[model samples]
Target: MKCEYDKDTESLKIELSEEIDMSTCKTLRNIMDGYIIKYSPKECVLDLEKVNFMDSSGLGLIMGRYNLIKMMNSKMTILNPGDYIKKILGMTELAKDVKII
Candidate 1:
């Protein structure tokens, strides 16, 4: 997985290119936390368009970020998720939590 943070928009855009499994989850979490704290953006965008697969761990990441951003009076958005990821998001009932635009 590759992550990038845009300090200007306060948007942490994570480009997940592979499966979001246990091993990658740790790296992702660490990177995301760093960006969130460094930029302190009012919004976050997770770009899942390149992601092929994701498990519950991925869901947990999204939820965690959502909670963190909420506390800061910010917002989180998921952008261009593939079909598989979309299903998982829907099943997890997070469609409304993030924008899919």
Candidate 2:
């Protein structure tokens, strides 16, 4: 995963990889957690544009980030998720908590 913070928008953009599974999600969660704690961005955008495959761990990561943002009184958005990822999010009803765009 790659992270970029925009001070102007107070948004942290996390670009996830093509495949998101247990191992990758773990590392990504850690990095994102730290960034959230440190910067306290008003909004977070998880860029799933490149993610063609995602397992349960990916859902976990999204939920965890949603909780984190909620705790900080912020917002989280899932950006550019592919069809498969979007369907998964829809099935899980995660869009209720985080915007999917």
Candidate 3:
């Protein structure tokens, strides 16, 4: 995950690539949490344009971050998730909490 805080937007933009599976999600989650805690951006933007594959762990990561963002009175946005990831999210209720673009 590549994280940067945009002061203009007060958004912490995170760029993710490769696979978000069990093996990588753990590290991804930790890194994301650290960024969230550090920046506390009003909008947490997750860029998944480079992510080729995702599993349940990826969905879990989104949900976990959404909850954290909400607790901080912020919001979460998901960008460029692949079709398969969109399908998985559509099948569940996770989409309700996140704005996907």
Number of the top lDDT candidate:
3
Best-to-worst order by lDDT is 3, 2, 1
TM-score computed on alpha carbons, candidate 2: 0.91
Query: lDDT tens digits, residues 1-101, model 1?
Result: 56677767767776767688887888888878777777778888888888777898988988887888888888888888778778888886677767877
| Candidate 2 global CA lDDT score | 0.86
RMSD of 1: 1.8
Candidates sorted by TM-score, best first: 3, 2, 1
| C-alpha lDDT score of every prediction, in listed order | 0.79, 0.86, 0.89
Stretches of candidate 3 exceeding 4 Å from the true structure = none
Preferred candidate (lDDT higher): 2 or 3: 3
What tens-digit string does per-residue lDDT give for candidate 3 at 9-73? 99999999859899998899888999999998999999999998998988888889888999999
> Least lDDT summed over 10 consecutive residues: which range in candidate 3?
89-98
Clashing pairs in 3: none
Candidate 2 Cα misplacement greater than 4 A, ranges: none
Of candidate 2, the 10-residue stretch with the lowest lDDT total is: 85-94
